[model samples]
Target: MSIWWSLHLRREAASVPLARRLLLGTMETAGVDPDVSYDLSVALSEACANAVEHGGDLHSGGASQAYRVTAYLDGEKCRIEVADSGPGFPAPGPGSAVRRGAVPGAAVPAVTAESGRGLCLIEQLADHVQVSNRPGHGVVVCFDKILKWREGALLRVS
Candidate 1:
């Protein structure tokens, strides 16, 4: 079975949980394992929080105030993407080939740092992660995880 959904949400703190809850509900209904659902939900929350805090230009007065979350469950994998409407990540310097966005093997934030841990946590939870800047637009965080269905899953892939 294949399932997919997308949410266009305002960049607000409350929107984070809303997106997370929707994802959990969808996974629950589709019979995803509770532990797997929980992990993704947490990752989704982090992504949404990032979008809420940094997805807009506070001083620009006209920057978009919305972000997007999209999820896909197909075959044996589930993929989630959170995209924000702020300035994209700065271009990586010549010697920093993979430093633009958070890749799985990239350096993680220091433990005592106050912020910037969301991407690192995402890298840990998802099987594969890719962070990219959309030219002339925002940044996108995309992640995928192999699925493990419950005993009697409704949408289990054979």
Candidate 2:
């Protein structure tokens, strides 16, 4: 029995708490352990913050500026995707200076007092993080975590 949940909301600061509650509830309903729930909540909070801050101008009128969150539990793995309607910036490369504390490409500057770090935390928390621009739209951030499922326990069907 797999559990899944999704939400589409306006990109407002007020929506952060709502997103957090949604994730927490989903995690609890999916049988995630308490410790795992804490970790997931932290990761989800960070992701939502990034979306609200850098995703786009949520104050602008229309649906193009909304934020979306989707989550699902598939056996021992949980997947979450957060997307926002904004012009997406290029994420740092695998070995970029941002990752190595060196310098990025010739056009990009070294890590200074202004930027770098969000992705680092996200990488550490989630088993996997994927970022991409939605075609003709905005940006999407996908996160996945592996849950330790106890053996011999039957999954609840809902």
RMSD over all Cα atoms, model 2? 4.9
The weakest ten consecutive residues by lDDT in model 1 span 97-106
Q: What are the lDDT scores of the predictions, listed in order?
A: 0.83, 0.70
lDDT of 1 by residue, 63-89 (tens): 458899999988889999999879765
Clashes of 1: 0
Alpha-carbon TM-score of each model against the true structure:
0.85, 0.76
- In angstroms, what RMSD does candidate 1 have relative to the true structure? 3.1
> Per-residue alpha-carbon lDDT of model 2 for 36-98, expressed as tens digits?
666777777777777778777666667656789888888778888888877666555666553
The parts of candidate 2 lying over 4 Å away from their true place are 90-116, 134-136, 149-158
CA deviation > 4 Å runs, candidate 1: 58-63, 91-108
